[model samples]
Target: GCLPISIIGLLVETTHLSLVTPVGWWLLVYSTVVQFCIAYVSWFAALARLPASVAAIGTMAVPVIGVVASAIALGEPLGAGQIAALVFTLAAVVLATR
Candidate 1:
């Protein structure tokens, strides 16, 4: 909770930050709030109940999930960097699960 607030404050404090357009700031805030609710809080709860290795595999799904979501939500083309991230995430999951 406090960590998330701290992270948001860091994001807001960055001079490099700027909205892509008029509504971008609103969307940024909304998405950040939603992600904090869904992923961050839920993950913390899940880790408490599950083995750390199991929890880690579940958490590592994020990059792959993001790859698919970006395709759907943003119509973004998959690039080499993303592909690499996905591969690394997959390898990590496999190693951790094994």
Candidate 2:
């Protein structure tokens, strides 16, 4: 999929280029590979032990983790409504798992 888009973009002379140092590009690629490898391993491990229904529901935590991680790491704000929603989601997940 990425190869087709890349080929078309190059053929159309509309390919956008970024200015990153060689080291930076290498680091970016390395980190992407490492992160994906870790994610797949974690996913497979979870599926090995968790029931399908529970694993399906477990995916709901991903957004919650993203919200919290962004607030902490990126200094993003969490409003009252967001906090309430997070609480409700966590409560539902916990209740459903039980």
Q: Which stretches of candidate 1 lie over 4 Å from their true place?
A: 1-28, 79-88
TM-score, every prediction: 0.56, 0.68
Write one digit per residue (lDDT tens) for candidate 2, span 1-98.
79999888789885345767789878888888988898889888889998876886758788889999999999999999989999999988888777
Give the Cα lDDT of each candidate: 0.82, 0.85
Worst lDDT 10-window in candidate 2: 12-21
